[model samples]
Target: MRGSPPCGTAVGCMLLLLLLDALLLFAGQAAGEGIITNHVVVRLHESAHDDAHQLAVEHGFQSVRKLPFGEGPLPLLPPMSPRREANAVPRKRQRLQKDSRVMSVLEQPGFSRQKRGYRDLNEMEVNISDPLFNKQWYLVNTGQADGTPGLDLNVAEAWGLGYTGRGVTIAIMDDGIDYLHPDLASNYNADASYDFSSNDPYPFPRYTDDWFNSHGTRCAGEVSAAANNNICGVGVAYNSKVAGIRMLDQPFMTDIIEASSISHMPQVIDIYSASWGPTDDGRTVDGPRELTLQAMADGVNKGRGGKGSIYVWASGDGGSYDDCNCDGYASSMWTISINSAINDGRTALYDESCSSTLASTFSNGRKRNPEAGVATTDLYGNCTLRHSGTSAAAPEAAGVFALALEANPDLTWRDMQHLSVLTSKRNQLHDEVHQWRRNGVGLEFNHLFGYGVLDAGGMVKMSHEWKTVPERFHCVAGSIQDNHKIQSGGRLVLTIDTDACQGKDNFVRYLEHVQAVVTVNASRRGDLNINMTSPMGTKSILLSRRPRDDDAKVGFDKWPFMTTHTWGEDPRGTWVMEVGFQGPEAQRGVLKEWTLMLHGTQSAPYIDQVVRDYQSKLAMSKKEELEEELDEAVERSLKSLLSKNN
Candidate 1:
């Protein structure tokens, strides 16, 4: 008689309906709506919802649901609703009385942003096995003629130390990674992977037909492909977790989209390995937008349980036609800029020289024969025999970081940098560019290779008992408006004595990075070269002649050129900048304005502590060795006496 007897009984039907309602409510609260997903969130005074609902309804916003924990209402507006976009809120809300129940409204941000040829699976796996592993000279060089026997990443020893990066997570901010690849599947972390291009969760490359879409998968394999699985050679951190962030798949990348991708899942993702950046062309100069900058800062300040997320960036691959300083992301003080060394342990031709570079790692180079490139996992469950570029180098360093993290899980972003400076092996390959000189603190540095090649064993050993650096100290000097005209065959040298480097809460002795913000106008930008010399006599080539950069009228405009070459150097002495023109013709340039920002800390205490620790350990080790020797000598004497008495 009433709705087919209402589930055969009135009371039973009512109870069933109530249970379903409760389940639905629970589900809604659990899967909370996105902040700006066609909804406006508004918190109302207790018991004032009735009036708020009336007002919302009057404005055509349907009070769809209440927020969890009694936070507020998530009201969905129709497509035709006025002020649909969060950025365009109604002006009348401000004029409304204090009792209007509107606390705050902000625009919820959103984000939007390959493979080898075919082959049989078994054959490919066999072909990709460790038979070629020995050919990976970057892992353990056995005197490869052109390379020193141990001029490698020292990863094998780290592996022997039982650190395969078991608990670290490195997010590859690249095109896409093939999660289904046999070599990478075991270590891939799906929870940390995302595709900003399709607004989906999986980050599989859009195209898998050829090697073009295989970049991310290759990079993933380098970071954390499965180990000894008979699938591929192995990754640097073969037991670590790798996740892909597919933001570069889109043709164009906006700042908001990049912000979302870089800062995605900061609480979970540990290290972000970014190989791509703004146009590497010499003429182009670009960097992160405001949102993306904030995102990077947030990542370091909040990620990895507050130890801070590690960011490894490729310095740039525009060496032939551009300088790495032209690329903003690499030159930014926030990143650990990585440049490429060849398998022969020499600087690669395509590797840009920049003061911002932190360290170097082996990669493919044209200078060597048989052209060795990094081998790792590929598309379609296969493996690739070659993957090269600063792209390849960055992931390798990221893998080393993963190993370091696994060895010592509490390393902050700055701690990693400090360890890098302390343990990296300076290349002594007899190359002119790779020559090293002492900084203010007597630490050797080379602009072509930064501190030097990464040493996984040394880094991991240091990480095991490393102490974090002191809080960062900052000092700024100048807007020295030097509108001096620079003509051909002339040079301008500017000097500033850093007296502001000492004060309460503002003291900095050792340096991490120094940024020179220069403004210049030139008739030919490519004809200009600039360098800075610290009081320690460390020279940083801030700008080099870029033959391809021909823009005449506009030079660096308040451009921030950063250098890490002066690391550990005392920041209290006179700093000099030399700008000169290289062109033979009478071309003119104007040095408009420039500023210097130094970032460091009172590192004397930290350095002293480290030295003391090292000395104590060394003494203990020597005493132990002497005791062992003494015991052996005593045993020999006893045995000789026994023999003579017998």
Candidate 2:
């Protein structure tokens, strides 16, 4: 210190000091709990249920709940000091497994719900009454904004039929809805709204610096904003009521929170409409945790007095770069995944072609201006002229569902799905990518457009006379555990005898959905595409290549891929699955495990009855068609003569 160090030694010493400072900073940051408190969820064996709380306390975790409805509850203790972070949940799980009473432990994973982007609203002068009605081409298209004429939900026809969504309620499960908005106030159902994020009775979205809180309001307007009030455009179901479930205000969502949110007030909430999910960034693949999964099952099995709550989810905005097959919520068989179509009746640019998507609805196109987006209510007592994305598409479907519910309040969730299959009309798109094909049941379906666009009039009319579907029947084909190596430009086929569909307790005739839980190891996940062939020779392209997934180490692991294209197909012969690799990634892949699940109606004789009825209706329709043609010709002649005289 007195003589001063040598130049080299001094430099080394200074560098050492800098290293120490950096280490301290990093360690402090890692150990400092920002906003999230450390907590662990533990499930115990049934034998230890009575002493669950005492065991949790001994293990230094507080018992959040004992004998929870679904899972055992134990909240682990925080770190002893702020200087050190809590152990990883996986590590803690291993440690907890040492205890005979502990069954499982999971560190709560943080989730960021997807957010939709919208342009700022511009002030516009309004002179005409119902100013925005003319702009809502989705409700009644009149060639506005270059949109196709007569390409709409046919809500006007439904309204004329006196089915305007009365006595139906849809919960907008988003940030919040501006109930005070002029367009929505009249139809706001305060009794059904709740803010789970803030634990408040009123589920109002909080205003933040970003001000993206208008999402729920826009969705609400699309579902049940009042009609003829002359504020914004009319909703698909104008007379229906909408409630807001403000659960997305926080940045992080837990399994328990989401489960509670989905099942919250299930007795009164007829339909839960959600537009948010894992990021649309293309690289992320995520879904609900086990507790949330169980909750969805419970919702369908027990909610709404055993009628099942209708769950509508957005198909996602990940586009061709990313597929919705990776989205857990949209891919689930329990949810009705709604995709988006443009006003021109083409598949939206951002629409990811997934077999799980049930139907499509109108939304703004990627090439069009935001003004072409959905015109609906916004926050702050204002109305948005444009709200876009699959987010907007879902609530539109919900509104249509509300009308269906009003038409027949007793229709179960599965009945509503059958209505969609029978009523959704196939739109002729100019693009070949949106090619449509008939499923086994003679219903036209497309991966890009699903079962085509929702027809509000058709759904409501059918709902009025809808017979509830037969009880659900399930059959499982044992796992094909063989391993086959797949190389670039190679294809592998696996076949299974599906005679199990004829089992005594598992009676299945025509299929509703087919699921394949697959395990594959590939050099790159994006290089694989899978196709499933039904016993009747109908092909369902379950997975297209994901171009954005470049992870070289891991591939699909028990990832379930589903298809609705197998509808009405016999599940009795040898079914085949083909996996192909298209890329030359210099590495090969192996298919490890595949399990097949067939879900169908147990009514074996219904198909014959349906065929008989169809034949009878076809004979009557032919006679009516000739008469209608003759009347149209006579009307045209009269119109021509009138034009000549004028």
Candidate 3:
């Protein structure tokens, strides 16, 4: 009788009982599976001004605070006294619901904050036993180490699809890898590894007090560190075989050493990951010498039983001032240059902006948190979280390439680059300096991010059904031999008009990579900036001003400054190159010669189809946007009409 609703008639009693039942149902739902607090959020009607306080007082609430949220809900807090019971918040919510002034009441359920883990259930299927697996944010960003959620290589999804680089082999061309390390020993390919420094079969890193020679080992771990072994951490392709090519440990880097290292066991190795380059001091302009160039050419032509060997190079860590085009290795059209992004989707501080960079991967950012850097195996069976820079970025890309190779082994090196351009994602990747722009074929690219970050899952998926690209051919489009003087504070603009060798044996219809090979001398080389504009109106900054370069005597000589910005664009029109000076003190320069190099296939049917698909998608997106605008306008008009009628 005490709990029964008080009413004058049976119908009134039934209505009261229904209202009580509704309140109890809401209370039960709000209290389900959550910690109950002694507070209730109450939303007052628009006409009930200052009634929230009165209602709280009547409901025995000790204090009320306006919630800075939608509709200005007020949270009523009960006093912490012996009279308070566990159901105080729910009882207050029920009593407030009975007030005509109150529009709605809800018990404020308490929820604890938690770090984001695996976003997808499939991510947990790969049982990684390594202790530092959680710290490998680049592999699977779970919002760990202050990284953004879903900003990663997406390797887990690829692994979930049963591609783990089982048949692929990657070679780490660095100082030397500790092949004897516990995490790498099982995956080490002895037949493919050799020490160009020591000229021995064993490619073990030399002993060092500061672990300076551990660079190759760390890079190797990034590609094929053993998984489920409780070692350092999992690799991007944990089942891939890794070979160490010790070439950077010697006192001097020779053409033979670099050549041998690059071409080492090419038939056995699927991908070659090179992180070292010319000194990133923003002044040095260097690349593969004669023999090394030949070796790279041979590898691409004859490697993988003529399928072509994949070459992955680090773009550089010369920061904003230094352009990666200054480094010939990264700017090389034969190599797939990779840049680095931080965990927060920002361009890394040490990243070099270059148009030739093919893609991007994650590296350690400016954050000094304990788990901020890459987790990989170090020397003497140790693990490290200090691997940073574009040096660390290249190996991650190589590992992703290994995954793709395992998915489809017949893919050629050029095919790998094609897949990279088609499959890499622009997932939250942004550069504060350079904005993303679409090419003629509707592919987006950035100087800092290239074609965007390498997507392991996407690449693997695309590789499984990919067809080998058409035969690649190079055509020297145009050449200018006249000396053009660039006065102090003045710029020199040159234009080249050609048909891109139409009807020739080596004709290029659809562009792949463009190079502006120039021989120039300047009073201050660092002050010079170079840019190239495609026929399709896409501009690529071939070289940025390098402040640290003080080499006034020796300027660029036959330097091949390359760009991938004009990929898939028609090359049968005029091309523009702008050579300008930007520095505190004006400097004089002269462009003695410039040659335009175009490398691409004569015909690519896929590119045309890609453009059509993009156009269709763009049309659909515009249509949807117009429909949304119309719907919004109609709703606004209806709201106005209803208000006038009321």
RMSD in order of candidates: 31.9, 33.4, 11.2
Please write out the lDDT profile of model 3 over residues 1-646, one tens digit for every residue.
Answer: 6765569666567545554555555455544667667656677887785776776677787777876776555555554443356777666677778889988877766777755533742346667778999889898887888888789999988999998999899999998888889999999999998988999988888888998999999999999999999888988999999999998887788888889889888889899999989999888988889999999999999999999888999999989878899887899888999999999899988999988998999899578887899999999999999999999999999999999988988889988898889888899888899999998778899988999999999888778767777888899999998999998766799999989999989999988999999999999999888988888899999888899898888898999999998888998899999998988897898899999999999888366554345436655765566556556655665576568769
Tens-digit lDDT string for candidate 2 (273-293): 999998887766678899999
Report model 2's TM-score to 2 decimal places.
Answer: 0.74
lDDT of 1 by residue, 499-603 (tens): 645775777777888999999988989878899988788888998888888888768888999988888778777889999887566778889887988888875
Clashes of each: 6, 0, 0
Model 3 CA lDDT for position 161: 96
- Candidate 3 stretches with Cα past 4 Å from truth are 1-124, 608-646
Task: Give each model a TM-score.
Answer: 0.75, 0.74, 0.77
In terms of TM-score, which candidate is stronger, 1 or 3?
A: 3
Q: How many steric overlaps does candidate 2 have? A: 0
Among the numbered candidates, top lDDT falls to 3
For each candidate, the alpha-carbon lDDT, in order, equals 0.77, 0.79, 0.86
Clashing pairs in 1: 113-197, 114-213, 114-214, 115-210, 115-211, 115-214
Displacement of the residue 516 alpha carbon in candidate 3, Å:
0.5
Question: Arrange candidates by lDDT, highest first: which order?
Answer: 3, 2, 1
